[model samples]
Target: MTAPQQGSDAKSNDSSSFVTFSLAEETYAIDVLQVQEVLKVTEIAPVPGVPNYILGIINLRGDVVTVIDGRRRMGLPDQAPTDQSRIVIIDVDNQNVGILVDSVAEVVQIPSKSIDPAPAVGNDQSSRFILGVYSSSDGLTILISLEKLLSDEEWELVRNI
Candidate 1:
């Protein structure tokens, strides 16, 4: 795995940066700092008795990284990935895992003024994984909270498997 490159303005407090990606038909973004790298989908070794959403584990430059299928985690039906599928490597609570996305969009700068709190009811589970919503010219992009998305329990299970 490649080490994270320190931004030139590392000392600056920036809340507008985000790395966007696609899942099914929806576009989402997460704090760019939370992202470790972007990789191609690779072969994974299955671990029996684990949740279906947990695809399996893959060797990432000598590091065994667990892979999570975002669609399945969100209660969506399983579907084959297209040419655009990507593995978004993220560091959650110091554990590295790769989340399978339909495709990666782009890195965007979302000003604080453009972000709004997630709705309370309609998107319960999805909202739990979200930090905020950013409205852009293209459309709405859900900003994900990586630490909350992959809490300790989730990582512990992956680590044990």
Candidate 2:
């Protein structure tokens, strides 16, 4: 919850920067501007009666931030946290939320023209959150829309948590 990088320079007219991270062995990115800061996996105080995706809450400075398990949210199996695991605090719906990622890669700046629209695939709940895709030399990076990461009802539940 502390002010680290404001990410003011994460966007431009010709291109947009992204904060890339790994999840379920796949690469995913979020608009860099939405990223507040990254923190190492810490002791999470688990809450009862919440959904499985809600890993629990963390005492980030004086703020009680809800940490969501990215794997669970994406319908992927859960894995134990490793040394590379991190909590990526992102700006979602005007509030700071933490997304547990496998490992953070890097901040990549991709040209606007290079970004491709999300493919028209079968109706999948997770697919709705995909903003676009970027094929880089390393591989393809799935860009996600944090706003759609959760439904209005889900957001309300998180707020109540």
Clashing residue pairs for model 1: none
State the lDDT of candidate 1 residue by residue for 72-115, as single tens digits. 76555677878899999998778888899999988877767668
Q: Each candidate: how many clashes?
A: 0, 0
lDDT string, candidate 2, 1-161, tens digits:
22435654434336788999999899999999999999999999999878788999998899989999998887777899999999999887778889999999999888888999999762476788889999989999999999888665766776756
Q: Where does candidate 1 have its weakest 10-residue lDDT segment?
A: 6-15
Q: For model 2, where is the 10-residue window of minimal lDDT?
A: 1-10
- Cα-based lDDT for every prediction: 0.80, 0.87
Structural similarity to truth (TM-score) of each candidate = 0.85, 0.88
lDDT of 2 at 9: 48
Question: For model 1, what is the C-alpha lDDT against the true structure?
Answer: 0.80
Q: Any runs in candidate 1 off by more than 4 Å, and if so which?
A: 1-14, 152-155
